[model samples]
Target: MKWSKSSRTLRRIFTKSSIGQNPTSKGKWGTSLTSHRNKLGTSRVISTELSPSSRRFTRRMPFHHNKSKKEPNGILHRSQAYVAFIDETFKGTKRVPRFMDDNNIVKGREAQRWIVDTALEMADAVRHTLGPKGMDMMLVDRMGNKVLTNDGATILKSLETKDPVASIIAEVAKSQEQNAFDGTTTCIVIMGELLRRADELISRGVHPNAIIKGYRMGLSQAIAWSEEISEEKEAYEAGVEAAKTAITGKSAEDFVDILSDICSRAAMVSSPSEMMLLTVHGKPEDAELIEGLVVLKGPATAGMPTKAAGNIALIESEMAPPQAQVSLTDPDQIKEIVAIQQAFLDEIVARLVKAEVKVVFCQKNIDSKMLQLLRKNDILAFRNVRRNDILKMVHALGGQLIADFADFSKSDMSAATVEVVESAVNDYVVVRGDGIKAASIVMPAPTEQSGEEFQRALEDAVGVSYLAVQNKKMVKGAGTIQAQMSYRLLSGEGCATADNSKVEAARRAFAEALLIIPQTLAESAGMDLMDVTVKLGNSPGLGVNVHDMVLEEMNVFEPLAVVQSAMSGAVENGVSLLRTHSIIMAKPIQEIFAEAERR
Candidate 1:
């Protein structure tokens, strides 16, 4: 009965050996704030009717710091510890404390439907914005910054709602975005239809428990059905298909194949590759891949050539004056220290010159003297290189990382084809060689805002495609997979023969819920649902042609993992709300303290 939210556990830790034997012994007692009790006495938390006005008492026990090693548990004061003491005194029997309080309660079907309805209220706004024809939502926050997007997570999160149930639903959409990386809108739409079907069954006198059980049954069948119909393509093919499907409802509809191809290439060469966006005074359609690793830094000094090709030397150590790193407290030795530092730098430059090394990449700082020495030796050097870039460079240039400045072994040096190119405002170092396995896709937009938006969309496409390749599974998109799963569960072949009415009910409800995706797709595209349905009939390849407003087989597809993630998230959330009968708002600790002192 002693509940604590910090660690998320409520347990009784008895301070004294015996409660009845310790009546004269001064100590604290356990406390239970809720009035709800299980009929079978098996539930951790239960639903029972009690007046919210009922005042329950709780004692504030003093926790003194006991330094003694023998006294493990701290001392407790038994001031106003009646409720838990009485409950413990009569542990087995129903002779419990009388002051349990309840705050929010709705009895029977009303409670079941009301919670689902409240959750769906948030889902309603985002469900319509699913599929290719989905409309964008413009959200203006308190600061009045307008964000225009069709992203389900964005729309749900941007809404300012005070209802707690509504927040829970919003959390589900957000969770989908975080976990699956896409399908935020599809998840909301699916769960909304799930509750709608559950409500429908409840109106027909179906028990809420039956509907919950049936929903589970239907979910299992839907998952199995989806698993069966999933079709996979080669890495590039699958990536292109997945990428195209992801951008269906997005603003870059015209460049679907072009975007998909770039994402596919990036995914194939670089698993989780870095995307670089450059905003030029050009159209977004001019996006293309660079056949080299993008090192955003320019050449270290103007004395270094803009382009050079030779054996590379990668130094993980600093190029600064070695004597500067040491301390010289005496003023008289300052000139001596400077001469020693200059000599130290002179040796490093001499070694590079002897080894015939062309370009030098240093992880740490380069002193001005060392820069001059390198330039004097006709060797190009870049300073303060990023660690990731350094690693990629080693992999690309086929070079070894030199940790010691004194060792200039020929084995440590490798080949590097370096070019310092000037873009609109900044310079970039493009490092490429035969050994590099990755590629960089650079896209330029007409404006900074448009370029950034395209970059974000491209990132989503690339991420999903990479995941699809790694997972090795996919499902037909354009609402085809959802349609198949829907038909499978609703056909009565998936769940009717189980002889359990509850499972049958859940299966039916689940099957009906799967139609939400295709239904929304049809609505968004302004096509007749019946007409689209007839066109896609039983063919796994056939999907809605969003562009031409016809049903045709196209490359629209999605990762199987994406659909699976959305299904699991939606079912878990819907069932959690379905099982609830009441919502409780606990009184503040001060109110309980006031009541305890009065007692």
Candidate 2:
């Protein structure tokens, strides 16, 4: 009765059969018939026919079925057709998969090798510019910007490089800057020396691990020695010694005097706790002679005389009375507050009149009423003096508050005493003249805005001095000696109080020196450290170029299997070079890596 459905279901099951299964079974027939009946509907019935060849066949043909002679394509057979169509559509296209292209692959092992080599190269470039007698590098930027300085960090930072290895060298240079704040050249030279030593080991077929081990040992010793060298009992003494060391065999007395004077000035103005002075309207040259420190208590806008010769009367407070705080949130509040504070201000003016204080410095804004009162009392008052100027003015005022009001008189004016005198320019006061006047040269006070620039200049001068000393030692030339003398100045001794700075500087110098080794090797490897630096400096997109160059030049073998392997090679080579050579070679190498990584 349902033989047609059964026979159709059997055909479906046999078509789906794989390698193993029973060809005929009653249970299979039952299951097949049920599945076919459920899909085709219960009303559909199977019909059977015996062909001319006596083969029995079942057919369940609905009204929609044609029951044609052609056989249906099997599920597996249709799948094959679909796959063929898809394959044809995408044939001969540029969609082939690959792993080692510029966009995807990073030849890390090659980069590591290049980095190590470039580090050594850079270290060697500045090797001679080390120690107290180190030479300077004249850096010229791409825009033809010229910088004549011996600071190792400055020189390395300024150079253009593209090698990944060179960037690593630059890091070492930066490390020097951070560690020493000075003697960057020494650090780079030391790095170069170490790198050279590492190269020697590599050439000799020594295991990189062994070389790295030896280098680490040497670095440990060098670091200890560096710490010892930087250790100082007294800041002033250390400053003097550093100066002498910086200028040895060339105007010894002048160098000592100059250093001492700077130390003294730093101590006086910056406080004995810190050996650095910030001037808003003065230069280092102005503080050449020890005239005690002063704090001018006035407005920041008030201009002081560039040079004033005579006994100076240093006023600790403004010539004008203390200003009363007034809320000017409302426009009308200004007039009312000014009127209300006028009476109290007049009484303070009376004291200044009696004291005959000529120049007064105010820490607050000057109201019209106070200005009028001061004018009537014939007192000159300046407002908003900077902190540095306040210190200088207090020292010049003979330690007296001009106003003598309770609020203004609270500051310690003992340190504000000054020598007052009449000068050709104007009536002036010197903070602590000691009766000595050497052509008063007025200059703008040092302020936060200009302090960094001035400090850079000072650092450059020091670097130049270092270079001159180095030149003398290297070539024994009279020109170098003369140059040293030209820059030399007399200063006092045991005046500085910056112990931490000296120690830090020493530490940095040693660290920097240690970094120069690998840089030299990078240079030897023909890596263009400058190009790498320039690309990194200009744009991050150029990092690809840097990475490519590193891989092309530094990889020892083809088809690096993993990135870690390359990284290990680089680190090992870099560390080994640093240990064996001076940092002079290391500076460039460190710089190269720094540029590439944007570090």
Candidate 3:
């Protein structure tokens, strides 16, 4: 080969003829021969032809760098080669890699799909527990304890997975539980449906933002339609209906008639913040509503009157002797302290007696001497009552809570008829008289598990009933509002135009998603889902009655607030999840610590 002054051969040139023949054999290389100028203004060419044994050594020399040429496909090509070379040159030293590496992060479509799938899994876990005919789930903990529940919030909260989408769904369910208290399953089911539809539209080339906007539009129409279709009823009537809806599927279903009246009466008498629940061990049939408050504790002493009718006093201060800061070493000093404490007790009793206070609720302990004094005065007293109970008593009887005995007066007391009900297991103080403002539910459960479930059921009932009374609105349930909302959103004529096709697709998807509630209801009740949903789509005010599988105007009613809140919350959360384009999971603490130790 002749060396030209205009170019430099970085490696000895090899042609096909040169492989086995003489080194000077002239063989024109094929199209693989190329030339490029280096940064130093020198022309360079790298051409090689070799046998299998020497092919590993054929690498592009540093002087022949070409930006326009594409790298050949192989493990040892281009960037891979650079990485391998760096690793070989610094084999013993540590080099920090990219953040989260590639394995720990999911981006773009994959991340969105993973989130949608995870959310759907969580939603499905609770979907089977939707509506009145929904089934219950048995949750067993690591210690072998079990809970059977159909409450969506309970089921979602019981899920022990670490998936982020599941966590978000759980949080949304928790919010639903706190706000409306009876629509967690509805909220989660709607969220899953929205995400499913949104994913579909995204696959069909619709933008996520367009889907989100359509969801907002659907939510606005739903809220408007809900308010328009709601019925106005008296507090007690609404409470009765709401309570029935809340209790239909629980273990307390056998007591529906009895509990509905009790819950309604409870809500009618007192506000949600003022009403109290007292659970006792007995049959569910034994549950009753008390016209006034009942404390689980009895009078402080046996000699005190079991029943009295006079003024009720709520004392926040302790009726015991003050703690002596100075320790006494002599009997004389101790006796003096005792006499002073007795005088203090006598003064407290005299004050109560003079004020005509018949009942006393103390937030702190009462000294033994004070109990005897109160007994002599024909007054009933309870000591060490919880602060919450004291507040309830105050709110119930319209009395002031006095923290200082010196501040106690006739003005601080309220009139009440007090009675001590003695039982084999416990004693209760029932206070009922004129001007009493609070109501109490005395619930009897046969077992601890049943008691907890009963409480959960009542909590939902009371919360929704109270909200109904506050909002003064009730919507038809059993997927009535959902079907109507879906139809109205899809009825827009402009949604079919080409200029707004993306938005139109999104609107149509959201409309379809809204029917998932009705579909799930039909499925749960063993009805023909397709037939029921199609009929529901045509009928405006009619809803499926799960008992008969008939599409008609059923008497199921839910609070308007619950319906609107569930729809809005579900859509907002679904839009939020759709906007998430990437997810990067952090390394476990153990792995981080190990890596640090190695460093």
Candidate 4:
């Protein structure tokens, strides 16, 4: 074959002939002759022909390249020019891979490890701040929103990263949130510290197994310590102390006595059968007194006495049964039940209209029908009386039962001469006639606008105070005798008196306070596990290794930007950093170390 190239195209020319003996063959292929033809000036082609059968047997091979393509599947390698350039400029080094890929990256579990380590390192950096004096974290979100908080869960949750391991740490924070409403911050700090310690252990070449064993032993002791600390007697004392601390911060003189009095009242009133009473309206000068402990549902009206003086009627229930117990399960049942209840309620209204009963309290539903009837009869019937209100009402009135259409003659009316004194400042009425002066309080209100604000404030104060005390004790590693007692008393599982409702409330408060310590410890330990293990044990040659060391190295391998990004992602996903810290921190250091040793 001969070929020639032109400006537009290339051309080829061929010359060949075959000769045969047969007449047809002789005419077309008998002669073996060669002919040269001009193709595009100088191009020539040599041709070889095959028979039809030969052609049918021939096959073409697929094309293959000797060298792999620089780019595969349209994806650029981490070492690619653009990637390397960007990484160098932003990361200040090209040693680390820019993207996740098999050749130049850690992915899957390995990637997760890197993330976990990085997060633990950050946690350790703040571990010292585990107590009430703990430090705060300043976080800036992707949108430039800034948050400053000492909450561990908040910090962990705020972290965003593509690393799966780091995400696991974030999960620890979530666990803490569920276990302990507070202490997320302490947990996170503890986790970070543990990891840091683990890294030191690793450097010392201590076997991971030994560290793991130690950690397990320590955890066992810690759990036992928690149990010991939370004894009932101790818990009560702690509760008293906590209350004193809170009150004293607000007032310095004999705050302990005042708190003790309040606690006594709580113990007395907190009963499932009765309402707890707390008085919160006192004269400005008497505000420091903090007396008249009654649990009422709503706030003191515009102007009311914070302290209750005089005798109190402690009614345990609503003065009347529900007009109806309407069942939503069946439509017909609802109407029939309501009608029946209304009929019974009408009789009670009739009696009240006769002026036999001055104030009436009821639990459960008071149908619209009953309301209209009572309004028409000029009988004030308050429905859904809270536990606190019941106690107060019972205290004020001598606990009498007025049934349907029961007419009290002049003698009966005069016999029960507790006059109702309406307070202009509070939502309760004081019963003061017949030389009987008593206050009525309520518990949870039926309506949203009724009494939630005061309840929430009290709950918050109690919850925070409890957490503070627990954190303090855990930091000291002291036996938690107080915590145990508080838990039993407050959880309503102990052998406490059943009648006094106030005592029950106090018990619950104590339990809440005792619960804070262990929860915080568990969360903080978990967080530190990954890092602490690494510090304590040398890298495992082949078997299981400490999570702490693993986490530390992983963090060292990851860039700060990745860490920050992962945290941001976590927060955007609605994961709370505070919660994450609590969970990670809650893991006992001993447990992690023990696991390491076993490995």
Per-candidate count of clashing residue pairs (backbone under 3 Å)? 3, 142, 0, 151
Residue 3 lDDT in model 2? 21
> What TM-score should be assigned to candidate 4?
0.35
For model 2, the superposed segments whose C-alpha errors exceed 4 Å read: 1-109, 124-146, 157-181, 199-209, 220-241, 248-273, 276-415, 418-599
Q: Quick one: ranking by lDDT, best first?
A: 3, 1, 2, 4
Q: After superposition, how far is residue 274 of candidate 1 from its true place, in Å?
A: 6.2
lDDT per residue (tens digit) for residues 1-599 in model 3: 32121121223343332223332233222212343343432233334443333232222323222334323421111321111111111212121211234355667886787777767767888888888789999999999999989989998899898667789899999998888877998898889889978888889888999988877776776677667768998988888889998999888888988998898888878776787788888889989998888888987878788899989889888888777689779999999988998888888888888899988888998888788788877888999888998888787778898988876799989998989888666688888877777788888898888888898888888888888777769988888888887887678633332247787677677778888888898898889987987797778568878888778898889889998888888989989999999887787899999999999
Off by over 4 Å in 1: 1-122, 139-147, 153-181, 199-212, 232-234, 273-281, 308-370, 377-416, 433-435, 467-474, 494-497, 527-543, 547-555, 576-599
Error of 4 at 594 (Å): 38
Which of 3 and 4 is the better model by lDDT?
3
The TM-score leader among the candidates is 3
By the TM-score metric, which is better: model 1 or model 3?
3
Residue 142 displacement in candidate 3 (angstroms)? 5.2
The residue ranges of model 4 lying beyond 4 angstroms of the native Cα positions read 1-115, 118-184, 199-209, 220-237, 243-369, 375-599
**Model 4 per-residue lDDT tens digits across residues 1-599:** 22343332222222121111111111111221122222211111123233332221111111111123323433222221111011111211112212322233433432322333554555554443343323455678889877654445556777776544457666766665544333344345444434434334445554434433433333333344344433232433443444332232121223335433343233232321222333444322221211122322331122223222232222223334454433388888777776766667776566555555443445434556556665554444445556555554445444543333344432333223222234334444333345324322333233332233323223322433344334323211211222333333433332333343332332232233233333332234354433323322332111111223122221101111111222223222221221222122124689989999999
Structural similarity to truth (TM-score) of each candidate:
0.64, 0.38, 0.74, 0.35
Estimate the TM-score for candidate 1: 0.64
lDDT of 1 by residue, 334-354 (tens): 888878888898888888887
Q: Order the numbered candidates by TM-score, best leading.
A: 3, 1, 2, 4
**Worst lDDT 10-window in candidate 3:** 80-89
Better of 1 and 2 by TM-score: 1
